[model samples]
Target: MPVIEVDGLVKRYRDVTAVDDVSLHVEQGQIYALLGLNGAGKTTLIRMLLGMITPTAGSVSVLGAAVTAGARSAWARTGYLVEAPVAYPELTVRENLELVRRLRRLPGGTDEVIERLALAPYAERRARTLSLGNLQRLALAKALIHAPDLLILDEPVNGLDPAGVVEIRTLLAGLAHQHGTTVLLSSHLLAEVARLATRIGILHHGRLLAEQHADQLDQHRRRHLHLGTRDDTAAERVLQAHGYHPHPAPGGGLQLTDEHALARPDQVATVLVQAGVPPTRLLTEEEDLEAYFLRIVGADHG
Candidate 1:
């Protein structure tokens, strides 16, 4: 059974649709990421999935239980972190986690989660005294204290340093790979999620533009062969005469989009060599995730 299922989900506030007709399913142990920029409805969609907000149309099923207000199907087995991390400012880190432990009726694990998130150093310190990064860590620790079967995080890496980001990435990966946990996270950082999420869905202006597996992401990105020679004019002339289309690259090189060049770079090299304009540099350049995202979004509107 899928861990999360959304069918024709839609949310709107007086004509301003926050989430369009979006449908997706997350299987067990799969890390699905909702990728979009700010005001792209990622948070709205997440809120609907968590039963925090109601959708105008369609349905949401989490852990095989239909989600409805005051009737969460698997509340005990789910963990989530929404928009901004909030906590009792005066409560110490340990006290806050202890509250969660008792409220959830859990047996133990407050200390284990604190250590796991590297918050032991500030365990006794008040939440208000911790830095932004450390406060974010405490939020994550609360979500992980019970080791819930499903974890839903929004912009999970917000307010963390480079090292802390790496740590969180490793922890989530381990949780999914070693233990059987399903994750659905939202972030605008396409490049970062490209490396972490098993599957990705692109959202723009309250609509889902595209969805693809991480391994198959390369198929959606554009690729071209780059060629550079000592004599740029001669190389361009030779390429055109040989029926090859060449465009100037942004960084003082020539880019070739011809299928023949990309499929057989060796042939392209031989052609240049025979013309006495041997390429000084020949390499394939694939578009990055950010560029691909902008291109697709622009194409949708353009």
Candidate 2:
């Protein structure tokens, strides 16, 4: 069975609909990422999944159990980092984790997690004194302290620097690949998610616009052949004569979306050179994830 499941989920706040008819599933050991802009209901959907908020319509199931308020069993095997990390201002890092250990009745000491998250240096430091990056790490440590079977994170790397971001990514990937832990995370960082997530779901205007396997992203990406020559008009004319439609690119080059042209850029170079317009630049460009995301969202709004 899928580790996480949402069926026709909907949430309404008075007259405003926050999420509408959304449904998705996450299997064990898979990293599923939800991408969207601010105010796109990503947080609201996550809240419903964690049973923090009741959905107006639809159902959520985690670990083969229905998600509802006070579903202790379901929550016991789950770990989450939602929004900003919060800690008692006066509590030291180690003390905060110790508190979580006792509250969750977890059967382990805080030493392992402290080392795992590289918090030993600041273990005795007060939460109030930690930097934003360390505070984010503390939140992650809390979520991972119990070694839960599932993790649901919202912008887990928000306050992290480049190295910190890479560290957390490796940790999450290890958990999923080595331990079969399922992860569902939301992030606005398209490139980061593209690197870590096995699948990606795009949300917009409080709705799911698209969902696709991350590995298949390249296949769905639009590819174009870029050609440049000393004589732009001649190159364009040559392409047209060969029944290929060319468009002007922003960088004073010609772009062709024809499948045959994209497939055989070498042929394009040959044609251009044979026409005495020897190509100055000939390359095939595949749209990156960020560009693809913007294109998709733009089309949705258009």
Query: In terms of TM-score, which candidate is strongest?
Result: 2
Per-residue C-alpha lDDT of model 2 across residues 1-302, encoded as one tens digit per residue: 99999999999999999999999999999999999988788999999999999999999999999998788678889999999898888999999999999999988689999999989999999999999999999999999999999999999999999999999999999999999999999998889999999999999878899999999888888999888889999889998998899999987899999989988888888888889999898888888877888887885344
- Model 1 TM-score, 2 decimals: 0.94
lDDT of every model, 2 decimals: 0.92, 0.93
Model 2: residues with Cα > 4 Å off, grouped in runs:
299-302
- The local lDDT score (0 to 100) that residue 46 gets in candidate 1 is 95
Q: Every model's Cα RMSD, please? A: 2.0, 1.5
For residue 215, what is the lDDT in candidate 1? Answer: 88
Clashes of each: 0, 0
